[model samples]
Structure formats: C-alpha cells, structure tokens
Target: MKDMSENERVARAMMATGRYFTATELREQLGLTVEKAAATLGAIRRCKRYITQVIGSPRHYKVKVLKVLPSPTWHCGEVAPPELTDRQRQQIHYLSSVVFKPSRGIA
Candidate 1:
C-alpha cells in the first residue's frame, strides 16, 4: 500500500470529523508546526474539491473537508498559469497607470 501524503492525511482527518478544524487543532492532532498546519489547510481550501468551507480571517482560519481527493498526477512539461481575478487585473492596471504616466516636462 502506498503511504498517504501530508495533504491526504490532513484531508482524511478533517473529513472523518465532518466539522471545521482550526490550525491549532490540526497541529496538536498531527504533530505539525503551526505554519505547516496553516499552509496545508490553506492549500486544501484553495483546491475547493476537498474542502467544503473555509471560515474566519486569514490570520485565524478554519477548514471543513468534504472529501479526500486523489493526489494530482505529475507532469514533466510546462503548466499553464492560473487565471487572474478581476481584482488582480484592476490592480495591475492601476499600478501601471501610476508608474507609466507621461511626465509634465519638468527640468
């Protein structure tokens, strides 16, 4: 049998509980550092396939796992970049506008 990755282990634990879990709880249960727990949970939440919901602010978040997703297959080629959100596009436009404005001929 193949060993489970940390992400799969975390997902299984949350799915078994069927309740939201804070980083603190995960850390204690899985013997993980606070940063590791938080990072793992954040990645799971972003995937949206494994996580049902995410609660609380960035500094203190909680996650509820819906199901354990199969590990992603690895590829040996370049991958497409993620699409940018509208907000990100707007931010980029705003920054470019501010940075590349024509200077009023000041000596």
Candidate 2:
C-alpha cells in the first residue's frame, strides 16, 4: 500500500465525496483555516492534473480521472484563451493610455 501526501489525501477525500466542494467545506472537513484551505486547494489543483476547476465559480473544482495511453508522440489539444470582458477591456485601455515619466533623480 502506498501512502498519500496531504494534498493527495485531500483530493482523494473530495473524490470519495463524488461531488464538487467549496473551500469552506474543505476547510471544515480538514480542520483548516480559510486561508490555509484556499492555499492548499490551489497547490493541489496545480500539482494534480486530474483536478479541474468547475466552470461556474473560481472556488469550486472537480476531480476527473482521464486515462491516457503512453505513446512516442502524444500532444494534448490547445485551448484558446478566454475573451476579455468589457470591464477587463476598459481597464486594459485605461492602463495603456497612461504614460510613465521618469523622475529627475532616477537614472
């Protein structure tokens, strides 16, 4: 039997639950603080390929098992970047319009 790491254990627990969970629920279940839960969840998501973000909310995620065969040449499909929202576009435009002037003291 192999021992699982903390994050792996968390992922397994979530999988066992067979549903998506919010950070607060995970925190309560794992006896962790909000910040710790969020940080731990974030790290787990980054390290575990099977763990995927839920489409509706940033705080939610789901674990999906994908079986991929090993091959000499295997390439995953590329995903296009999400389109910028109106608020994001306005922020970008505003920032782009601003010009930074070097101070006299700065070399």
Candidate 3:
C-alpha cells in the first residue's frame, strides 16, 4: 500500500466524495491506527474550511465540507422509505458508516 502523510491524507479526505466517514473506515483505508485517524480528522475540522451536517443530534465522525450536492430525487423509480422505522434507520446508518470513509490519514 502506498504510504501517505497526514496532511495529504487530510486533503484527500476533504476532497472525497461521500456523505460522511467513520474514523475506523478512514483508518483502514489510510493505513493508520484509529487514534491517529481520529486525530487527523479532528485537526482538519478545527483548522480547515469544512462544514458538517448532523444526521442526528451532532452525528459523530463527520466533518463535511463543500456540500456534495445529492442527485435530484425523482419519482421515476422505487423510493426506499419516506420515514424509516427505527430499526431500519439504525441498520441503514450502520451500513452507511462502513461504506463511506476517508482516503488518507496516517502510516
């Protein structure tokens, strides 16, 4: 795997296309320990031009910057849910956390 510096990783992560990313997923992709990944994300949020949206009351592990505009919703296909049941939302949220992550961080 190609090694990356913290700054480079943070830059790439900031530019990544996604809704959000968990520190664990970032750690895995960037080859960094969890602690280091978390620290890098934190630093980026603190020092860079980024915006965050809370999926819940302050969703963790996300520092959203440059709003990634979502595709326009169309009635041309099946809709998943208008209002997800609690259990379904939980499942969706969990899977989402895993699928989205940073491209760089440490080690």
Candidate 4:
C-alpha cells in the first residue's frame, strides 16, 4: 500500500471521528504548528467528498464519509475491443486491396 501524507493522515483521522473541528482545535489536538494546522484543515475542507463547511464564524468544518459502489456495467473479466461496423469493414477492405494490388504501371 502507498504511504499516506501528513495531510491525508490528518484528514483520515478527522473523517474517522465525523465531528466538527476548527483550525485552532486541530493544532492543539494534533500538536501541529498554527499555520500547518490551518493549512491542513483548509485543504481537507476543500475536498467535498471528505469534509463540509459548517455555517458559523471562524469557519467550522465537519468530516463526512461517502459510500461509492462500482458501476453495474463494470466487470473484472477479459475485455475485447468493439467489432468494426459494416462501413468501417468496407473501408478497410478497399484500402487493403488498393495497397496490396499488383503495381502494373510500375512494373
């Protein structure tokens, strides 16, 4: 598995709790620098899938987890390219015949 960045770690921790937090609270709880805590919280809040901005002064944010399922048409089996249409097949046939035909004029 890939290693998580500090930002990702902080976001995941916040998401796990699913609670509202402010930048100062993050700094105090995580022992981060004032700027780092504010930056991390700002970055996390921008990711709509993971966090949401709550209505208030001083900017409170809450983490949210969204469930996503694989598309119904998606499959893990072998994949094949789509077959050529009749018009495409005809074009290929014409081009092939033109290229491979005996060069009577040159000969």
How many clashing residue pairs appear in each of the predictions shown? 0, 0, 1, 0
Give the C-alpha lDDT of model 1.
0.80
All candidates: TM-score = 0.58, 0.47, 0.42, 0.50
Residue pairs that clash (backbone atoms under 3 angstroms), model 3: 51-64
Ranking by lDDT: 1, 4, 2, 3
Q: Please report, as a residue range, the 10-residue window in candidate 4 with the lowest summed lDDT.
A: 65-74
| Candidate 3 deviant stretches above 4 angstroms | 1-5, 49-59, 67-107
Candidate 4 global TM-score: 0.50
Global lDDT of each model?
0.80, 0.60, 0.59, 0.64
Q: What is the lDDT of candidate 3?
A: 0.59
Give candidate 4's whole-model lDDT.
Answer: 0.64
Q: What tens digits encode model 3's per-residue C-alpha lDDT throughout 33-80?
A: 889888776665555334444242344746554542332334554445
* Model 4 C-alpha lDDT per residue in residues 1-107, reported as the tens digit of each score: 34555877787666666666777878887899989988977776665435354545555553332322222232543345579999999888888788676676964
| lDDT winner | 1
Error of 2 at 49 (Å): 3.4
lDDT by residue (tens digit), candidate 1, 1-107: 45766887889888998889888898998899999998888888887457467788877778888876655544533345679999999988988788776678987
Best by TM-score: 1
Residue 62 of model 4 has an lDDT of 39
Pairs of colliding residues, candidate 1: none
Position 57, candidate 4: lDDT: 55
Full ranking by TM-score = 1, 4, 2, 3
